[model samples]
Target: MTSPDEPHDVSSGVSSGAPATGAHGLGPHVVGTRVVVRRLVPGETGPTGGPAFTDVLGVAETWWPDLVVRREDGTAVTVPHALIVSGKPVPPRASRLQHVPGGEVQRRVRGLWPGETAALGDWLLQVSPPHEGRVRRRASSVLAYGSPDRPLGEALAAIQDWYAARDRRPELCVAVGSAEETALRAEGWTEPADFAGHAVAVQVGSVARLRRALGASPHTAATGTVATEHGPVAGAAPDVERVRVSVTASGDRIATGLADLRGDWACVHDVRTDAAYRRTGLARRIVAGLLDEVAERGVTTVVLHVLTTNDPALALYAGLGFEEHHTATYLGPPR
Candidate 1:
């Protein structure tokens, strides 16, 4: 049975170009995700005079003998699995925080790295000591966000000139799939082959959730010690609170991480687990310790960055309830 609340004719429903099953197919995997399902409506006729089919759009609540969906309006729709002819999981709706200005996010994340920064209107250029004859993207890329208060060509030229004068290859870091990245591409900027798989995923979540994942109450008292430091951006005003956490066993450091608090926001970075201790839960301890320290300081939100290709790190953060807020990739000079 299709929910009468949101049923449309099959003629305008299923896409003719694609298979009845969605790109990822329809099955148990789609439960708990927003999905659209098309099912036949007996005794009703569609616009084409054929048997009527109705489409249900909502979060898939259950997928077994029947598919249950909860619509945005708080209504639940149950459709028998035998009647579903087409369905697919769709991307989730944007969270309220997703609408925050990209530039602000760039500042919050990239600002955690040590660097000398120069501003170009709304854009920020940062430079740090070179490593292995190359600069880490976060340490030396132009953070391409809002308008540069100049023509696109002029901004590009300035970025090039600035880096060239510094004897460094120019790079522009932009939110992947953003208009800014697309615009730069049209101007010939390309992702360097060497950086092919280096896209970074910026993730955010609640501190309480991470604490829960640590097998403790969300409001557990802070434990361990945290050392405070100043903001990494040279000449910038110090952040409200910056702290580092380390996990040691037998007087040897096995893992460490840092968090910087800006008002109510905190960003976690520089997390590392000794290669020998990988998968030992030390990383989670480091994060949990950091969360404990920051939570006492009134920080409720936490953010972190993970390499898209690092399956372990991705899984670690996801398991702690972090969701990808955006992805960033560096664009190199025109080919």
Candidate 2:
């Protein structure tokens, strides 16, 4: 995860203080970790007129007499130990659902509200008061994804202490079935009673596809003027990350959706329609308007965090060509 407090260090090279050759900064210790290795390609010549060198990115499967790497496509490549020139551990690849890594999306999402964020290695500890008369779990919870960069027990203790100082309950936003979730479970951490067994899927789709689907569906092409407003939201800076689109008919607002744009991606959330306007295709118009707005700003993809149990919402997004990329569960402190 990229910390809100600092940039991620993704430099790959020979491990610090290691030689330029032999073992190539790899050992039995790195066998199970993701890595990139630079090795000599036998019988090949380089542009420099020397022996060719190729870099392979994958998990280090073995480091005995020979080094074996398992690539993202699930193929294993073996390199002679004598052929290795340099290597180092690398971060895991992005999940299938991620157009950009989820951590990056979370970072941008956190920017929706002005707040203080501290880093526990790559994990982010968010600090803020409740907004709009509600305690947004994402605002109050620790983003316990990626690595803590410390012992699990130590990280957990720090998290609890950090929240305790603020007189707040400790909560964790962790990817479902992730190592962090498993470790937290083992340490007595569990979901809050209200959220037990519930998870939110982060679904993503292309802006072009969504706009096409919405435009092609006569049911969604409702007759209403869409008003787009861009400015501060939840008290963040003005004209930055916030956008709200609504459908108004006869001077009455009937449907609306919100989006927070960051770089090339935008997240749509809090969509709603008046009960009287339900099934009138106003919701689709609002969504389509939001998509069109973001697309004008050069955002190619849109994201939504929908509950796994939200059948209607899931069906709606599926119809728009969105696919589930990953899911997250909220874990509260151990009782």
Measured by TM-score, the strongest candidate is 2
lDDT of 1 by residue, 58-135 (tens): 666555556777665546688876677788877755655667666687687666556577888888887767533545
Off by over 4 Å in 1: 1-95, 130-134, 212-236
In candidate 2 the C-alpha lDDT for residue 123 amounts to 94
Model 1 Cα shift for residue 232 (angstroms): 8.2
Compute the lDDT for candidate 1: 0.67
Per-residue lDDT tens digits for candidate 2, residues 1-335, read 11111111111112334233464557655654578989889899999898999998876655655777766554668978788889898765554446667676666666665566789998999877665456667767798878997998899899889988887788888888888889889989888887765788777877875566455323233656678898655555454477898777788877778888866778787787777766565655667778888888888878777777665565455434466777888888778
* Candidate 1 global TM-score: 0.64
Candidate 1: clashing pairs of residues: none
The residue pairs that clash in candidate 2, if any, are none
Per-residue lDDT for 139 in model 1? 61
Superposing every Cα of model 2 onto the true structure, what RMSD results? Answer: 16.6
Each model's lDDT: 0.67, 0.70
Candidate 2 stretches with Cα past 4 Å from truth are 1-100, 216-223, 234-239
